[model samples]
Every structure is written in C-alpha cells, then in structure tokens.
Target: MRQPRKSTVEIRTSFRGREAIVSGAAAALFRREKEGGFFGISVKLHARVRLKVIVVNSVEYRPDVDCYIRVPDPSNATAVAQGFAPRRCHVDDFS
Candidate 1:
C-alpha cells in the first residue's frame, strides 16, 4: 500500500547567522500571502545566546532560542490570537 502523504510546509528561518529549514504543519502557519501583504507569522525565541532568525518572507526575527512563541498572523489577528498559544522550539526542531 502506498504510504499516506504528509501535509507540510517549508519555511526558511535563520538562527545565529546560520540558515535552517523549518518544515511541518506548523511551518505552514508562517506562509506569506500572495499579494505581498503583511509579513508572515511572527516568532519570538528565548535562549541564552542571542540569535537572529530570517523568515521566508524576508522578515528578520530575533527571539531567544527554545522560547515558546505565538505565531502572529496580521490578516487574522483575532482568530490566531484565540486559536494559538505560545509554543517552544528547540534547535533540533529546525532542519
């Protein structure tokens, strides 16, 4: 039998000057709209060492590593604010 296909999105994020890939359903949350609208999702990292993260939309994010963050969607703030919560991400979480 064929294996079920996983629905995932790819997001290019950087940390500490190094580029990394974040892939999965969560990544889809960071996808930018087609009309060149507001920046994609907002991520805030909390780590001992300061790091810089570059998202797919060319927006720069500098949050602590291993910090829980709520993905911000400007288009639908109320929905995202109500539905999502701050989530933690580890270094290994990025590919």
Candidate 2:
C-alpha cells in the first residue's frame, strides 16, 4: 500500500484556553462552497507533533490577544522533519 499524500496549513490556535503553541499536520480539510461565494475549510490537526498545552475558561485569565503557532501536518511535518525548518528533525514516527 502507498501512503496518502499530505497537505499542510499554518493555523494559529488556542488550546486548553491558555496562550499556547501547537504545530499540527493534517491529512485533509475538505472545503465546500455555498451561495454568495461563501466557503469553509474543515481542518483536522495531525497528532504526531508534540505540543505544549494549557486549560482556561471565561472566568480564569480570559485571553484577549490572538496567539500564533506553527502547524506540522504530515506534509509539513515531513518537510520540517526533513530539515525544511531552520532547525529540523526526521519525522520517522509521529506516535
């Protein structure tokens, strides 16, 4: 069998409620178009990259600033792991 080709997209997201960074590699984020030229991209983050996490709520230290982070989807992860980033590693196993 052949591994499916992967696509990478950078997504700055807030996880667990705190200002954190998570790099994810995704397989597919299907898109659909609607009337009036409206579209949506559904992204399911990859699970290979190690991430720093935090948890917060509307009561405890609510964040007002938008955070920025890198995404390492299979393709991006493969790229980064293959010395694509400034400093890179080999993505042998994202397990």
The true-versus-predicted C-alpha distance at residue 59 of model 2, in Å, is: 10
Q: How far is candidate 2 from the true structure (C-alpha RMSD, Å)?
A: 19.3
- Model 1 clash pairs are 45-63, 45-64, 46-64, 46-65, 47-64, 47-65
> Best by TM-score, which number?
1
**Residue 84 in model 2: shift from native, Å?**
12
lDDT of each: 0.44, 0.32
Ten-residue segment with the worst summed lDDT in candidate 1? 32-41
Report the CA-based lDDT of candidate 1 relative to the real structure.
0.44
RMSD per model, one decimal: 19.3, 19.3
lDDT of 1 at 11: 51
- lDDT winner: 1
Clash count for candidate 2 is 5
Over 1-95, each residue of candidate 2 has an lDDT whose tens digit, in order, gives: 22223645554654343543333332122111212122232333333222323443223222222223233333344434644232232332333
